[model samples]
Target: MALLNKYVGITTSDGQSHDGFIAHVDQDYITLAIPTNEMYGQMNGMPAREATYRQFGFFPGFFPRRRFFPRRIPFGAVTGLFLLPFFI
Candidate 1:
């Protein structure tokens, strides 16, 4: 769709707003690539040691590194979608 690959803010039916890049859009859902810092703030406690290590590349992987956490939002729950001016 028009929003694919763009940074965006999404407001869901529950009134929660999520900011991320629109990675994929299909008939049923939109997948957003949420920043790691944003995902950390949403979590309940400090990240586990292993998770931190993985995030910071203490361990190696064959695939390319990922900087975002992928989240799929249902189309029916999306109330608003707009561009977000994010500075990295």
Candidate 2:
């Protein structure tokens, strides 16, 4: 399974927590489609309020709650995969 598929929660710097599916991910950002209206604001394209990936927590498998693991695939690997078709 994809690494992004395992993440379940996003904890903001302010201590707010949001639960949702990850809609998009980039080197510095993650888009979370949270269920609650309060958390929905993060999806808005406001530059001052965007959430960072440091806020996210992933569940490795069938776990019911979120957990944190800091290590991630390097950015170069992701870029290579994304650009592979062009080189092919």
Candidate 3:
């Protein structure tokens, strides 16, 4: 699923909202790298800051960083599937 590598937003039947990139998908559920808003804060009022290599800490000469734990939404528990647009 090409969408697996792109950002996605999903709403569940329980009335909760989650936003992230699809990390894995199967007959059961979809894994999303939902940002840890509590840990990262809302990032509001920080317009000059954007998601980039440096945002998560990067080093061209030393290491390339990537380690994320995405949330899961069971296929049956999903109430909506939003595509191509972001509200987060």
CA lDDT, every model vs. true structure? 0.77, 0.39, 0.69
Residue-by-residue lDDT tens digits, candidate 3, 29-65: 8999865523332343343444453555532222332
Tell me the deviation in Å of residue 19 in model 3.
0.2
Off by over 4 Å in 1: 38-66
Tell me each candidate's TM-score: 0.65, 0.34, 0.57
* Candidate 1 clash pair list: none
Q: Is candidate 2 or candidate 3 better by TM-score?
A: 3
Candidate 1 per-residue lDDT, tens place, 2-88, comes to 778899999999999999999998889999999763223222333455457566544323224347988999999999989988776
Candidate order by decreasing TM-score:
1, 3, 2
Better of 1 and 2 by lDDT: 1
Clashes of 2: 0
* Candidate order by decreasing lDDT: 1, 3, 2
Cα deviation in Å at residue 49, candidate 1? 14
Superior by lDDT: candidate 1 or candidate 3: 1
Model 2 per-residue lDDT tens digits across residues 1-88:
2645443555554455544555567776655544332222222333332244223321222213223223333233322121111111
